[model samples]
Target: MFKQMVIILMTSVLVNNYVLNKFLGICPFLGVSKKLKQAAGMSVAVIFVQVMATAATWPIYTFLLVPNNLKYLETIVFILVIAALVQFVEMALKKFIPSLYKSLGVYLPLITTNCAVLGVCLNNISDGYGFAESLVSALGCGLGFMLAMVLFAGVRGRMESSDVPKAFRGLPITLIAASIVSLSFYGFRGIIDNLFK
Candidate 1:
């Protein structure tokens, strides 16, 4: 079980990263990543939502949905769960960390519909992970998101000061940088399999 959990974690964080690899949650990835502080804040919020959503959804799917033949409702149910979690995060951030709350702007609320958060919950169910495994996977994905955001934030910082061709400035350069980052994650494709063996 421990080995399995570690593999799931490393795979999620490095191998199948939802941002750099799988391309989930691109909105916040691009929007919040302009500043390291905002990027970190958004990442933390996402991590919290992912873990909590998994905690809530796993039991609902395992104990309630499956047994009752309500599996078809998984999407709707999962969306509701994610939306609620995002709302909670938004309220907490507003009351406690207003700066980040302001910085995140619509992106924070957008987490409600963030495919990455929904993806983790649905993937947990689809992958047949147990409750603990699902939690670990969520945490791994969240950390992977943080890794990507933080790294990209630094890249964007460097780009800001560098002279660039007119055609490759602004969003063009941003997308190009993001593509490079995504390509870099491909290097980890088989690391987990190799390490476990």
Candidate 2:
């Protein structure tokens, strides 16, 4: 069971990364990845949102939706849970972590609508993960997202300092870099399969 949990965690973080592999949170992954500090802040916020969403939704779906046979309402239910969690997080950050709150600024609010958060919550139900499994999976996915954001921020920072063609500057260059990073994750395709086999 421990080994399987590790595999699930690794698969979520690497093989099926929400950002690079699944392509779900590209907006913040690009918008907030310009600076390392900002990327780090967003990473923490995203991870918090992911973990909390999973923790909250897993029980709700398992106890409420599944038993009630209201599975069809999952999308709506999950979104409401996520929105509430994000709002709670925003308030906590503003009151407790004011510096991070300022650093996160607008991106913090964006978490309310972040499909990545919703996607993970919904995926946990569809995958039939238990509470513990869902928590670990969400943690892995969030960390994977953070990893991508930090890496891209570093790359973009260097690109800013280095010479580049007029055609490859700005968003064009960032897109190219994103493509390369996405391609890199492809190397993990067979890893999870092999682990299980």
What is the C-alpha lDDT profile of model 1 across 1-197, one tens digit per residue? 89999999999999999998888989889888999988988898788788999999999999999999999999999999878877887888889988977866456676887889999999998988899999999999999999999999999999999999999988899999999988999999889879996
In candidate 1, position 66 carries an lDDT of: 92
Whole-model Cα lDDT of every candidate shown, in order: 0.90, 0.87
Pairs of residues clashing in candidate 1: none
Off by over 4 Å in 2: 96-106, 193-197
TM-score of each: 0.90, 0.91
lDDT of 2: 0.87
